[model samples]
Target chain A: AQTVTQSQPEMSVQEAETVTLSCTYDTSESDYYLFWYKQPPSRQMILVIRQEAYKQQNATENRFSVNFQKAAKSFSLKISDSQLGDAAMYFCAYRSGIGGSNFGNEKLTFGTGTRLTIIP
Target chain B: EPEVTQTPSHQVTQMGQEVILRCVPISNHLYFYWYRQILGQKVEFLVSFYNNEISEKSEIFDDQFSVERPDGSNFTLKIRSTKLEDSAMYFCASKGGAGRNQPQHFGDGTRLSIL
Candidate 1:
């Protein structure tokens, strides 16, 4: 079984500033994927970015990036030049990479979530 | 960009009644999945469908729950007997490409309210 933990229940950042949301996971599998999702007021879950365990290089998508420390089981999300639109509920999720089973494919274990507030 | 779409947007049902949530995955997608999130809880996987059959399901997907791809485009999840605890936001997702590396795209989700 795998579990994702988002220690920060809430985070706030001033407009145009930067913010980091922390996440950790416990997984015995060596190969897996980590993801960050954003749920705006519309409640639609949107993929922010993803990182593969095998890749030592952190993933970056525009303003969203991740600090992935595989040895520490930590994958934190960083939002640079944060905007008001970044205000939303953020979730950290883990998915196994073992093939031939749905457990490794479609199923994802998600953290409770971190509410991000962007202050003007 | 292609995206998954769900129907009804919201559903209200009485306890013990039947409720069906529908989704239309991306046209080229080879995998389908169902997940639910209680108001204040983490999202949980319910089931995954491929090749016209269920590939895997979670413990939460008991006998009372069923999934179907009745047509070329429609994927549906039916709860035989709705309970108050079944009230949540049900999301439908689709994954393309090969293996488990592909990122799954999620729909807007249907809010199921069981009274």
Candidate 2:
């Protein structure tokens, strides 16, 4: 069984600043993927960024990036130049590689979520 | 860009009533999935469907939850009996059927409100 944990229940960042949301996961599998998803007030789940366990270098998407430390089992999301629109709940998820099984490969185990707030 | 679409942006139903949430996956997608997010909570995986059969489902998707691909385009989630706990935003997702990110495309979601 795999589990993800986001210790921060809530975090606030000033407009145009940066904030890093922490995440930790437990999985015995070697090949896997990590993802950060953001859900706004509209309740729409949006993919922020993703990182593969095999890739030592973290993943970056525009202003969103991930600090993935495979050995430490830690994957954190960093949002730079945060805007008001970034205010939402952010989740950390994990998925196994392909050829596994249905709930096998792509099934995502999500963390509790961190409510991100951007203050102007 | 091709994306998933879900119907009934918002649904109001009473407890014990049956409700079906509809989704139209991308034309080329072969993998479909259903997830839900309760108010102020993380998104939870409900079920996954592929090759016209249920590939996987979570413990939360018990007897009350069912999924069907009635046709080439529509994938639906039917709840036998709605409950207050069932109130949440139901999301439909699809992927290209290959790759690592497999980047699941998500629909805006159908807000299910059980009264």
Best by lDDT: 1
lDDT of 1 by residue, B1-115 (tens): 8989998899999999999999999999888999999998999999988888898889999999999999879999999999999999999998885555689899999999999
Question: CA lDDT of B106 in candidate 1?
Answer: 93
After the best TM-score superposition of candidate 2, give how far the Cα of residue A3 lies from its true spot, in angstroms: 0.8
CAPRI-style class, candidate 1: medium
Q: Just chain B of model 1: what TM-score?
A: 0.96
Tens digit of per-residue lDDT, candidate 2, span A1-120: 889999999999999999999999998999889889888887667888889899888899999988889989999999999999999989899888754565433777889899999999
lDDT string, candidate 1, A6-116, tens digits: 999999999999999999999999999999999998888899999989999999999999999999999999999999999999999998887565553557889999999
Give lDDT per model, in order: 0.92, 0.89
DockQ score of candidate 2? 0.55
C-alpha lDDT of residue B22 in model 2: 98
How many residue pairs clash per model? 0, 0
TM-score of each: 0.97, 0.94
Per-prediction DockQ: 0.64, 0.55
Deviating ranges (above 4 Å) for candidate 1: none
Between which residue pairs do clashes occur in model 2? Answer: none
